[model samples]
Target: MYHVVVALDEDADRARRQSRAVADLPQAAREVRATLLHVFTDGEGASATEVGAVRRASDVLNNAGVDVEVIERSGEPAATVLDVADRVDADCICVGGRRRSPAGKAIFGSVSQSVILQADRPVLVTGGFEE
Candidate 1:
């Protein structure tokens, strides 16, 4: 089975886009498995599976007939995502990216950018809808 790690954040739209990207994969139901990961920063103690964004993504994947798992971690978002992906031996890492100027990205330190640059395996970045 092809495995994908989908890194999700608080944005519902971003989660939808990321989940849809995975659900749209070829023969997704028969061949793909998706792990939904959410990293809680600043020592926030919350259930990842209960998070709205995660739930929405899960619903989408479930509707598409893809096998799904939810994982929660606490730490820097990018680092945590990479660590979990490695632990799970994911075939691909998926993340949602918002449109940002070079200066904006440089100043804001985008998690998606960091994941893309640091990941050893394939990374699928889904762009958010035009704002």
Candidate 2:
């Protein structure tokens, strides 16, 4: 049974792509457990809006026939994700990295890199609404 954690960024494209990946992940997966994680970026990253999104995602997943969980927390995005990974002992963390220029990445660093480096498990990263 693998535990998959997806970081739900507010971008519609990212969310769509993330949804595709999760929905299409091999149905053969034994004991598949999926979780939608959102961080509210106000120093703690826990916002009512984010929490609602996660809850909505969870409902969608449930309707799709997959057991799902929604988790919302307050903290740095990367830090919050890593912390959740620990609590859930996740097998993989999925996130989307906006395609940005070198300058942008330099200024913002990489969310994917942060999760990969900070997490104890593997990280799956993709651009928003990959088509």
Best by TM-score: 1
Per-model CA lDDT versus the true structure: 0.94, 0.71
Please provide, for model 2 over 1-131, each residue's C-alpha lDDT reduced to its tens digit, 9 standing for 90 to 100: 77888888666556656655666677713466887888777665355345544555555556566667776776688988888888888888888766667787789787777887877788878664222
Clashing pairs in 2: 40-45, 44-74, 44-75
Best by lDDT: 1
Alpha-carbon error at 75 in model 1, in Å?
Answer: 0.3
Residue-level lDDT tens digits of model 1 in 35-115: 999999998888998799999999999999999999999999999999999999999999998987778777888898899
Cα TM-score of candidate 2: 0.80
Q: Give the poorly placed runs of model 2, Cα more than 4 Å off.
A: 28-30, 43-56, 129-131
lDDT of 2: 0.71
Q: Which stretches of candidate 1 lie over 4 Å from their true place?
A: 129-131
